[model samples]
Target: MKPKFITISDSIIKKIKSGELIPGDKIPSENELIKNYKISNTTARKTLLEIESKGWVRRIKGKGTFVLNRTATHQLVRTLGSIDSTRKGFNESLKAEGLTPKNIILEKTILNEGVSAAIVGRHVIIEGPVLKVHQLRYADDELMKDETRYISLTLCPKIDALSTEISYFKAYEQQYNLKINDIRQTLSADILEANSNKNHFGTTSNIAIFVLDSAVFADDGKVIEIEYSYYRGDKYKFAISAHPEYGHKSDD
Candidate 1:
């Protein structure tokens, strides 16, 4: 039999899936869960943590646990720039749409040379330690994307010691006196199995996801960082615009 906490959490998840509990709606408090389910304080807390871990809800300190819009649609307008620039653009867009934007650092570690070469590209030689950072991004309290960034520690020695919640570019400029010169990025898509990502994205199998790969360079032509990102397809729309002078002749 499943644990009591898991059973309780699943029941709440079902309500969220059924739309009986809409986004921003507060879930039962710890005391309420304990009284309603006859569970202990520890079990009640675990239940809340489990649901939050699955991206179905968010807990605000001193406030309350609230439902998140796991299926809300967001828009991404691609432009030529570094990851930091793209992040700033998205933050502004979310605000303009009346949504709150947040970035949560999930994990950070030092990448070995072998692992670094595989993800950061074989062509990029690893001269020093590489810092790998994993982050979850959200809009209006809804999870939107998972991002992984690999930074060259040799270029910015103090990066590994800083908090991942801060803007990387800003941190570099302020702490290391470095400025990003350019970035090369690529976009692709893949279908993700619902069962595999249900806990990560709170969705069923065979879901479409967008992937973005980027390499960042400094003004002196040295590579500074690399990024691999996954965006939920059902929750995001892409927009692109071009000028005739920058490309092909106009039809007119």
Candidate 2:
């Protein structure tokens, strides 16, 4: 049989999972736990400690124990068409939830042919150089994703001079009048240690992340851009769909 303290902790956790106890709400005090669960003071203290260790609740010196605001899941629907579809979807979803979407340019540089080929793919030939731009994306002021996009300067010349504040896809469509044909993408998940580069995400070490890699093609069947993106796993969920008529198997 499980210990009384373990049972008590589990019950509290159920309340949290059911949304009966929300973040910032104070949990049962030691005395209250002892009276309610008929457990000893030692058991009550142990239960609180166990909960705190699990990152569910935090105890303040004089303010009592309060539930931590756990991560909420945001769903991302993948669309097969358009160049800026994903970006536009993200912005719209956040706005629908009353959250403001923002992006910060972290770094921008020109990569030589060798480095560009190695990063993107050998099949993607770079005539001259590639412009790589790194960005941090946020929702409601909380960092949500990190992205690195490589653009072929041969295709979008003077792209480095464009403002990072605007969407690259929109800029490509409006300024250059380029039509995007398709985007091939892959998704994976991994745990990343908190490094200086990830500090803006406000996450600790060993955080789970969702990775997305995509190659955008122009109307002429030329690869124009490659993008690598990392999203906080705790904050986002993705749904993928396939159309059999489009040569995509539903089982895929």
lDDT of 2 by residue, 138-249 (tens): 8777778888888888788899998765667766767888776655666788878777555457666678888877766677867678878888887765554443223321
Q: What is the C-alpha lDDT of each candidate?
A: 0.69, 0.69
Candidate 1 regions off by >4 Å?
1-72, 78-84, 87-97, 112-122, 197-199, 239-252
Tens digits of per-residue lDDT, candidate 1, 104-138, equal: 87788887572333322335444557888888888
What's the lDDT of the predicted structure labeled candidate 2? Answer: 0.69
Query: CA RMSD for every model?
Result: 15.2, 14.4
- In model 2, the worst 10-residue window by lDDT is 243-252
Clashes (N, CA, C under 3 Å) per candidate: 3, 0
Count clashing residue pairs in model 1.
Answer: 3
Cα miss at 44, model 1 (Å)? 54
